[model samples]
Target: MEIRLITADDADRIMPVRAYAFDATPLTPQRAEELVRYMSFRLQNTTLAAEEDGEVLASVSGIPMRQNLRGVVHPMLGVAGVVSNPLARRRGHVRTLMHDLMRRGREQGRPLSVLYPFRSGFYARLGYLGLTAAKTVTLRPEALASLLTVDLPGEVRLRRIAEGWEDVLALQDRFLGSRHGFTEFPEYRRHQPRDDDEHWLVTAHRDGRVVGALPYRITEYGGELAGGVLLHDGAIARALLLRFLAGHADQVQTITLSVPPAERPEQWSTDFAGTIASTVAIPHPAPPMVRVLDLPALTGLPAGEARVTITVVDDALLGGDWTLDGAGGALTVTPGASASEVRLTSAALSGLVYGALGPEEIVARGLGAVPAEAWDGISTLFPRADPWVYLDF
Candidate 1:
């Protein structure tokens, strides 16, 4: 089978493979046409397919986006829509496509590739390590009663997403400035809600500037109100958003907010702990995974003061001995001298660099080997922090 970039003409053939892999419903002629249109729209991204003798077997798409890595923004390739024909199973077509995508991403100067996997283990073999998933805090709207009583300076307004799209994007860019692993959605995706009237953009404005915004959807009356991309500038903006959500107490029984793993909703209100019904720390069954595509481009990453040399094993893309020197709060990687101190796989290295796994945890999980003397340097260089991706795609 030959792997090549998928064009508009191949959309119909690949649609059936994707439908069989992801959707169980029968693909009637109308449904197939609709899916073809959708696939055609998504072709703006870099999509690839494996074909042999005029038949498409498997396909994948990579979206060029940006992600924050420890306060530094870097280009990232978002992988999605991986699917294979039933007859082509276990033929390694998907693996070939993924390798080509990673190569293209690295050539384009993107340092990272992230994806929400259908099966975590399947991508784990390709050097992708799991990052912390977003936390879903489920609680009754009454839990935010205290926020309503606060005399905040901002006024919260509910508007359609199109009316406040620019403000929302600006607010989100500010929010992502300090967040690690948070990725911004592509421009095409940002405008998706313009056509959907059901979506609501709740904004908190102070001094005629947008301080906070929460885009949410409430499908049915007395059901759950689901929040999306919750962004706040400060304490008052957060309080205002919570107060607005509390106003929905009479209409919705429960409010579910998707927050980063580091955020503590229980501390938002004194009665939050008592009123919270359930908290799914990792709401998605398969958390998002990441892989470091261009390691050299990650120079000057903020890190603790330390110097360590390590070897990356079993990584076809980036494998060898390298020295990581993090002194004066900046990391610099160079060729290792002589024998290395630690040895780990590329997945382990990705986890360490992303702050998802500490050096000790890496050792405990058998992902790496660390000598007693190298603990301080390794630990200091790769401190543990919960890396969260706010955007699903």
Candidate 2:
């Protein structure tokens, strides 16, 4: 079996496979052609793929993401899509495709490849580890009545995010910037953001200044018990819950919000009857895959720091643990740390960066260990930003 790059002409073969694999709405001929065209324009060839006999078996794409190191922004590839045809399932085609993609990404000077996986376990064998933990909670209206009854001095407004809403966008960026596990979605692509039929984007403005805001979209089934909300936090994540619930009180009896595993909303709201479900697995307990194409460049990320050494254990093929030294005038990562500052697998490192696992807990769980003094520094190096990838592509 041979895997190669996917060209625009190969859409006929690839689309059928994708439609079958996803088992969703069929990809029309025109749509497939358009998708390929868009992919060609947006992604570099290094991020393309196909399988045996020129058959488009599996595919993935990534963009060069830059990080500020010292004063420079180093590039990394944020990969998405790991689609494989059901007919080709269990054939290891996806693995081969990803491995090659990682090599190509690295060759192009991208030090790392990041992706949000459908199944954390499924990707580990390919060297991708769980970095983020998604939380899903079902909200009961009766339980939320008290929190909802509190009259807010501000007026609540609901509307689709539109052009010139710089205040809302700016407020969102400011709120999510300091947060861990979050990524900024550039303004250019907001034309058709997904809202799952019942998306609620409510903003609370007080005294003519944007203060509280929430971005929520829901999925409905036959009734309220089945349908729930997929909520992400903005400035007014907690505040908008009551009003949002009232809007859907009859339609969806329960509203669920996916949040950071560490954030405890129960403390803020009195109604805490619902159970918290983890969207992805914890401690990963799966094979972790990741590739750092350029070490010096990868270490020069813009989480902002004067100079520091961060130890990483990345076993995503061309993987190893080393002291990423950015501790001088120039940002540099060298492989000469005898003390093994922090020891964990590549998967563990991804999980750590994604805020999936706490350093202290990792040590307790036997996944890896870090000295007490080093914990604080490690946290600072890989701060949390709400690990939200704006586009699912």
Candidate 3:
């Protein structure tokens, strides 16, 4: 079998494998056309295919993206549309594809790769970390009344989505600036909400400028209302949340929406001990798996008087030792280890890089031990922050 970059004509061969392996829907002409067009845009020079003799058996495609790590944006690879023919299972096609993808990403200056894993353990064994974590909050409409006071400087209003799409995009960009692990898509048009859904586009405005956007979905059974809201901005999260619940109060009984992991019921309302409730961690929400392809690229460390030399053990990915020195928000990386070295695997390193887990948490998990001499400086090197994946692809 030969593994190599693919051309546009390769889509014809790839679409069928994808349809059969994933969606399982027959690849009709129309569906193939739609997919091929999208693949042309997202893939272009970035697709890889595995073929034996004259038949294509597997494929993997990636796009360059910048994901926020702590507050610094680092170039990364976003993997998607990986598929293999049913008969080709256990042939190591996917493994070969991943290794090539990692090497390519490293060469192109992308330090990380992320994906919504079909089997977390498979990737975990391949050196990917399960670090992305988020929470969903369930509360009554009445519970949001207290937070209405945080309403934006202006007012909230409904607008035609096609007309307000630009405004919505702007607000979302503003919100992403402070969020970790948020993937900035190539364009907002790719994520444009379809009109077929029972959803609404609304936003908060101040002095005729858009401050935030709220896109909500409503689900119902037997003519009663169930609530759905997506809040992206914490500053205006509560304010827009209040507006959503208040407007649908009479129509909806309970509302369930996502919030930061640290945002508890008590933080949502004064009566968390009363009517408010949650469905958090009973079955933890799965986050996108992360693999560190290039450590120095991802660890563009912040300006600080702290520094550390570390050895990252990535058996299937980029694994080696390096020295990381930083001052304030600036960082410098050397090819080898320093005397006071810290040891970590790809999984542990990903958590530290994304700020999803603190050094103490890793030590507590028995992943590895941290020397007392390097604890404080290394702790400063990897500050904790909530990193959530907002985009699937």
| Candidate 3 global CA lDDT score | 0.66
lDDT tens readout by residue for model 1, 294-316: 78899999999998899988888
Q: Local error of candidate 1 at 356, Å?
A: 1.0
User: Which candidate tops lDDT?
Assistant: 1
For candidate 1, the clash count comes to 0
TM-score of 1: 0.93
lDDT of 2 by residue, 80-103 (tens): 656777676777777777777777
Q: Could you tell me the C-alpha RMSD of candidate 1 in Å? A: 2.4
Writing each residue's lDDT as its tens digit, candidate 3 over 19-55 gives: 7866648877888788777566555547888999878
RMSD in Å for candidate 2, one decimal?
5.7
Window of ten residues with lowest summed lDDT in model 3: 274-283
Q: Which residue ranges in model 2 land beyond 4 Å of their true spot?
A: 7-9, 25-47, 63-76, 107-112, 148-153, 161-172, 184-190, 194-200, 206-237, 240-252, 279-294, 300-321, 325-332, 337-344, 352-393
The lDDT, on a scale of 0 to 1, for candidate 1 is 0.83
How do all the candidates rank in terms of TM-score, highest first? 1, 3, 2
Q: Give the TM-score of candidate 3.
A: 0.84
What are the lDDT scores of the predictions, listed in order? 0.83, 0.54, 0.66
